[model samples]
Target: MRYVKYAAIRKPTEECIFCKARDEVGKERENLVLFRAKYCLVMLNLFPYNTGHLMIAPYRHVPSLEQLSDEELTELMVLTKRCLKMLREVYRPDGFNIGINIGRVAGAGFEGHVHIHIVPRWNGDTNFMPVIAGTKVIPESVLDTYDTLIKYTHLLRE
Candidate 1:
């Protein structure tokens, strides 16, 4: 079992992380951005909850879904469906936890920039480590998972 610590506490900054990822367009691998669409983009979670945890957000920063236009909303769900399919094809997890955290009170890591999280889940994926030792056991590293998912980004285009 490989234990991975959670991400370090990030110092408060004015810049939104999603915007940074969107602006650094060409460096997809370095940015962990898998695919970019006209209205939205998909990127791997830097501190993933699972091996293939992914996030989808609009190119334009918005705090909530209500702020999104019809086009942006449509593409968001479209990309989300594609992500689900991609995760299904790659990880073959028994289940998934797909959700959006709209506000800071609702567990939004970046409350100012709304996004959806797609977390791949397997049976017994959790253990006593996180409960007792403050660490989680991840079978693979984030970079390795990024490399694996990068290969499937093309499939998302279709």
Candidate 2:
């Protein structure tokens, strides 16, 4: 699976992938972390549904938003807005699919660490590739996308 591409780095032994990304330092580029806020951080999705796909998660290891304090919740949404603006500025996508999956059944890849997904969509971006060949093509590489967006990290700070 394309998701497994990150397994070598986000090993099963790690307590939580998001926590690891939150704690680990000096590897922002390698980890695809674009920006770090007081309560949340932004990073490109390793197995993105589309180009410029990004995920925003709180620094805390809470599994649900209800567990987060008001400050955390506020910053989470604030950062989400920043991400949307940044994605729009950089990718100029036709539309977007923004959501949070709370559980495994709900499509949370990391059920124990809640996060929001921001997927950029274009008209007719989805084609027969996935239906026929069982593969989705991303026009740009994740690292390349990170590099392209990293310059705009300052937007999140403001």
Q: Taking the tens digit of each residue's C-alpha lDDT, what string does model 2 give over 1-111?
A: 466445434654457768888999778987889888888889988899999999999999888999999999999999989888988999899999999989767866787
TM-score, model 1 to reference: 0.92
How much RMSD separates candidate 2 from the native structure? 2.5
**Per-residue accuracy of model 1 over 4-51 as CA lDDT, tens digit each:** 322125434656779999999688888888899998989988778789
Q: List candidate 2 segments past 4 Å from native.
A: 4-14
Candidate 1 to native Cα RMSD, angstroms: 2.7
Error of 2 at 2 (Å): 1.8
Among all windows of ten consecutive residues in candidate 2, which has the lowest summed lDDT? 4-13
The predictions' CA RMSDs to the true structure, in order, are 2.7, 2.5
TM-score of each: 0.92, 0.92
